[model samples]
Target: MPVDSLPNSILAHMLAINNVPPPPLRSLPRLRLSKTINYGQLNALCHIRGLKSDQHSSLRLEAHDAFIKQYPQIYLHEKTVLPKVPHLADKRKSAVRLAEKKHQPAMPHNISAYLREARGGPSIDEEEITEEKFQEFLNILKKLPVYRTKHEHNMVWKILKNIPALTSQLSKEDLKILSKKVMSETWIKASTVTGDDGLYVLLTGQARRRIKVFRSLIEENDSIITSLYRDSFLFDAELKDSTVAQLYVPSKKLTVKKWGVFGSLKGGHEMNESDRSVVTDYDCEILKIPAKEYEKLELEKVKHENAKKLKLIRKCPFYETWPTLSIWELVSISKFKTFPPGHVLVESGTVISFVGYISSGYCNIYRNIVGLVDLPINKVKKMKKRVYMGKLKEKESFGEVSILLQAPFTCTIITGREVEMAVIEDKDIQGKCMNVI
Candidate 1:
């Protein structure tokens, strides 16, 4: 047999052994398959392996499931095991639970039980006992009659002072343990507990080191406290402004009587009313305009001054005593003005006569080409319009640099379109700085 016909011959022999019937030549020609898969051989292999048809099918299914689980996408799989999904913490419920745990009230444990057990318990005075046992002793002392009497005499007494030479020997954690004992013992009977200051005083009895650290912490929170007070004051003032505004309207009489609630004073300017004890009356005429209008103008002025000061602070580097721009200086020289489109406020290489701050418009700052003025008509028409290189927008500053430096402007500053600006002369800024120098 030819090399290729050997497999067909083997297949014929295998088919003969298996007693498979031969088909017509036409049908036999169409039955081409892999020469390795002879039915008789396959049956013999299956018999030798002791594999059932159903078992083979089940093995194939398991192989596919294993492949999918192991490879996942076969494109991107996690290189490392991911952390197991965690139950999300419920913040609101957790906070409520924590607060309840904190404020649960310090009910004294059974003192009778403690006393009966204490008679047989190990003595706390043993020098060989650990620092942990000393802490326990301090906790027990807080409940004893002797310590309770000592605390009432001075509720804010220091704990470390009671332990001879403790300050030199104990660690910060030990001190914290002592503070906790103090907190629990005093908190139950605390009268006139106010703020962190009171807490510090009660903790350490105003120890110099403790008080210094506490003051630093309190001062560090100054900005946060200031922000809160500012918002609260503004809210109250806004309410008063609204009431005053409504009352002073054309058809109504403006009236508000001064009142007091303990130390709290109301009506008139708080400052003026503090010096006198009369029911101050606010009149529409006294304000020189409608109360609402006057208050609105005052608020705007105050806001403007604050913004200008903030800008100055941001622009200038911090010195030992860096100063903000004075409102009086701004008021004396700068005035808000609008420029029409194509208005030339300053020319290139010319001294900046008046520096302008963009209040409500866009302006371009660009380098001037030396030979652009000599361009031919055709070339000029073909040339691109000069690119606007830099833009100044609302609240953005420009034009002060050259004037302050007393030098010619290095670039041409042109209005992109209609613009509003607050103009100030170079001399005005110098005058303001002179006072500081």
Candidate 2:
């Protein structure tokens, strides 16, 4: 029988009977004999392996083509196996590992010990400072050529100016005396050292003058003088003119007596006619005024009187109780005026200066008393009489409550006698005092 006409069962029986093993299943090598053979065998293999026939056939064909292109020698061999490949080391990772291995050990925990080791020796001990040691140091400093020089004087003055406590303790009069002594000593020293008057003139005439003026302003007690000192740039402009000296001379000589608690108690005792001693009064010429400048002199006199009034006001009970009212700030905004006897200082329902202090006299306090009855239109209007409150004497203050409350005065204040008052304006109290407090 022809091979193409044989029944498949009979052929399989015949092959099994002859021990042919079903004509030896076609090998993978046979599949490459023709493209048609490869496709048919691959599809049959896929069916037997339980995979999609078309997909498996395409994948296998592509892998076979790649293998044949890369290795033409082994592409046709069915039993060939690929050789093992070795992994390459990364150059960057190897270099990092080598650097870590070559580095020095970790640094010592103690910083000073590490520094000593690095420096190759122990460090030397610094000199200890004590009071005695400091004194010796000061002595050494004094022996230096730069000591007491013009530069040193300037440095010392700058130091003193910066220290408020030290400057506050020194009065202007004290600074004047100190300036004279320093100038004389510096003049002598400069003359001896340089063997010429040039250094002496530079030291005493220029340097010492500057020191005196600076120290005087720094230690000044009067706000007006301080303001003038600032306005004149440490008296540089004003001191150049001789006439300006006359304007400030009265302020320097004027003194205001403060009534302290002890002084008041003593004054009360001495108020008795028997205990009071008769005193003689004398007029001394404090400043020489030319006839042409008589009006200018009167204006200066008024200014001096006002400065005295302010000085006394600073010692009043109100200022003592509230120390935040800076004397300089108060003097800048306050007014000093004298009121005649029976003149009203403050009236009820009126806004005026917030507070006033009796500098040299007394004032009486009165409050309006409201009546209950309604008056007829034709009836004569009875003047509302104000009830008498107490009296405010010298060194006492009034109107602080009205100033604090920002309201009009509730009572009337009248001068009981000729009264000298230091009035702190309502605007000033709100502007300056409230900010500080």
Candidate 3:
């Protein structure tokens, strides 16, 4: 029977009788034989096809002899068998093409457009940014301290130019807000300096309604001579010694209790008590108004209160040593609290958790005295002997040493009269006010 007409099982049995090799049996593309056929049956199929088997291996011997004759060195050193199938050269060519394609330089569309513009090619039109938006951007740039230098300003411009969204279709106010946000996120170290030019302009303006005069006592033989202007005042009538043509700057050590209407004429100089002037013989109430209050009045009437608070702060010995920024921070965190006469502000041996500044009225300090027997009938009877340490008047601060040292109060502070004090708690200082300066 023809092989095509026979069953696969019968075909396999017939091939086994011919001694064909199993490998050659599989190489027959047209034949579909049983997968379960034994190796002996596959070997028989090669014999039946007139292909070489183990029993007749003369074909392999002939190929080996031909290879030895063609390449003697390879045949002498290494025993090798020639492959039945040839390798496709086209596969190597395809692989080389694939590798070249992967390594080829290809620019993205956006980058190409940028390059084209740089080369002065037909430029792509960017989305139009409004003039208002640009102005707002400039304002933010002006506010930043780092942008004061030309190089930093250019760097900022370059960055903004690269960001298409920042330049395209954002509103003026929105752009300003977004730019500030981006600046804060990117340059965390950058700080903005608050402008006080408006405050200065308001103080120097020619509006009499804006200025207020205050009277202060200048004691006899006092070395300090306070004046609105070092050389000359705009309101000369306000000064007690108006005849003096050559006005002198207040001594750096002079402690100015009240600022003249024009403030200190000499800028950037601090006045203290140790600073003496040429004329201090007259004992009269000097007329003056705080410049800080005058400046604040231009912004808001409520801010005028900050001037009094600032004055009080300037008088305190502890606050005098602090920087201006630190003083501002302290003032912001402190709140005013009032106590009636005979009220004990802090008891001896209690935890010192806060500091207080005497804004108004007086307070007395009493130390705990030992060796004095006391009755426990009432709260006042427990302390039979109390030694008065000192008195704290307006503009004085107490409890700072205890609070700063993180210790208990060494003495009891009692209100001698109805007093108002600015209290700054330790929690508030550490939590919100610390490191601000």
Candidate 4:
């Protein structure tokens, strides 16, 4: 009989009874579904590994076997291995729990805990600096040069507060910036603090100005003269027009004491490009401010000085009758001046050519008197003595009488402290105030 026409059961029985192979194995549609799945095969029984992560990976990631260890076999009946679907009532309970978590009352407790921890940490900047520490910092800054102003002092404190030495922290990068940009150092005893540029100051130990010897001189007791004609000659070519025309070289060692500023400072007008070496006598702590930094601070000081002058003008009773334009013009024309203590603003016999408004500190007004009259009885006459006439306090004016009469004043005006003044010289106020004059 034809195998095609025979029934599969009858044909399989005949072939088994005749010891013949059961009708030749035939390919049938959908027959392969009954076979056991090979490893790493995709089928309807398994989905794309049910996205194993919260962030769904792509097919490219799947090709790289990222989806390995997903199941015992590549293809599995997902209904048996996957989590069971929740009932309607259970889903409703889950939704209620999620809502409660979203609207929880303890949220503020978490926020407050975070803030407390942040506060408990070490301070990072000036705002976090304690009062005691800030005061100590101010004291330390007094070691700097005299150019330090109240505003600049606070700013410098704020700027340097980030240093690890001050903050009690460690940072290689911050230290590098500070030591490079803000200051330079010399570690050895014989080394020079400022061999190049910048203002030099000693923090610990002492140093001396190294002066070259010009000649050797003999005295009663063996002595070396470090300076000759110091007060006399106009020696310093660099200080040609300055009042400090003479050169000075100290005979004593360790003349520059601790915390003493020596280079490129405001008061050091004699500082030149010459190699003036300050040899350290012992282990020294040195600090330096670059010339550029000094220039920047000078600008800020000028701004503050101008504002202070404006304030002083408003306080002067003499300016109360002046018009607003005149006041502003005076403010613009006034020269802000600073004088050191014991400085003679106007000598006793010299002409007083400028009117001064003492903006800060006090001054002593003195009249030169004949100590003893030149008499025939005494062989030598006594020198003139200075008698204190009065005090010129802040907001007081000087040279007003001299300017009014266009004559010289007999009294001497000496600064009692470092004084700041708003000076209006005759040349500056020339023809603009003819009506007032």
Top-lDDT candidate index: 4
**Candidates sorted by lDDT, descending order?**
4, 3, 2, 1
- lDDT score for residue 9 of model 3: 43
lDDT of 2 by residue, 1-437 (tens): 34333335334544453345776444212322221224443333323321222434766455434433332222133555788554445666787789998885785687854554353222222243345643443333334333455554444343223322223434543332232222222222111111111111111121111111212323348665665455442232234353333221112221211100001111223332111211111121111112223334446766886678667766886576545346656766777778899999889997666578778889889999865555788555446779998888998888777777757888898899899777887777897777653
Model 1: runs farther than 4 Å from truth?
1-322, 325-333, 372-388, 434-437
Each prediction's number of clashing residue pairs:
0, 0, 16, 0
The window of 10 residues in a row where model 3 has the poorest summed lDDT is 198-207
Compose the digit string of candidate 1's lDDT tens values, residues 1-437.
23233234444543443356655445544334342344554434323321222434766455434433432122222368888775556776788899999999996786743652343211123344456754554454455334555444243234333432233333544443343333322322112121211111111111001000011222445553354355331111112332231110110121111111101112123322212111112211100112233344457766786566445434433322443345345545566678998777777788887766666678877776533334666553233244457766666666565766778876777788999776777777677744532
Give the total clashing residue pairs for model 1: 0
Better of 2 and 4 by lDDT: 4
- Which candidate should be chosen as best, given TM-score against the real structure? 4
Model 4, residue 429: what's the lDDT? Answer: 65
Model 1 lDDT, full chain set: 0.42
User: What would the TM-scores of all predictions be?
Assistant: 0.26, 0.29, 0.29, 0.31
Ten residues in a row with the worst lDDT in model 2?
256-265
Give a tens-digit lDDT track for model 3, residues 1-437.
24464444444553553464333555434654333435554344334432233535776455434433332121123347886675578788888999999998895568855753453222423344355654454454444544445554444354344433233333443333233222321111111111121111110111111122233434433232334333232321244563323323323332222111112322212432122111121221222122343343334533555666677787897677777777777777777788899998888998767788898999999998865444577423334467999999988888766765668888898999999888889888767764652
Candidate 4: lDDT over CA atoms? 0.57
lDDT of 4 by residue, 1-437 (tens): 23444335434543453456664557312222323434445332133443332334465346324323333354344445878777999989999999999988763445633542353321234456566665554444554435445664555545454533324321443323333335336456655454345555555577666554433232333233323343231122234343323233432543555435456534343553222446566777666656665555667767776788777876776876667766777777788789899998888766687889988999998999887656686666778889998999988777866776677778888999999889998776665654554
